[model samples]
Target: MSLASHLDELSRKHSDIERQINAAMLHPSIDALEIANLKRRKLALKDEIEKLKSQPTSH
Candidate 1:
């Protein structure tokens, strides 16, 4: 996939995970570990997006 498309997919995933985290926060029964795992995954996605954005894709 092109860099732009890859970034878009990562961003979409990040947003989805963000929504999931928010929704999980609203439920009293949600496990803290699950929420933490989601947060870690979200962070990883963000890092990947940032890394992709920073590099010169054409190089």
Candidate 2:
């Protein structure tokens, strides 16, 4: 996939995870570990997106 599309997909996933985290927070029954995992995944995606964005595009 092209970098732009890949970034878009990652961003979409990050947003979804954010929503999941917020929804999970609303429920007291949600496991803390699960939330932590979700947060970690979100951070990973964000880091990847940033790393990709920082690279110089090749012609």
Per-candidate local distance difference test:
0.94, 0.99
Superposition error at 34 for model 2 (Å): 0.4
Give me the displacement of residue 26 in model 1, in angstroms: 0.4
Model 2 agreement with the true structure over 16-51: per-residue lDDT tens digits: 999999999999999999999999999999999999
Please give, for residues 1-42, the per-residue lDDT of candidate 1 as tens digits. Answer: 988888899999999999999999999899999999999999
Query: TM-scores of the models, in the given order?
Result: 0.94, 0.98
RMSD of each: 1.0, 0.4
Task: Report the number of the highest-lDDT candidate.
Answer: 2
In TM-score terms, which candidate is top? 2
Clashes of 1: 0
Regions more than 4 Å wrong, model 2:
none
Error of 2 at 31 (Å): 0.4
Model 1 regions lying over 4 Å from their true place: none
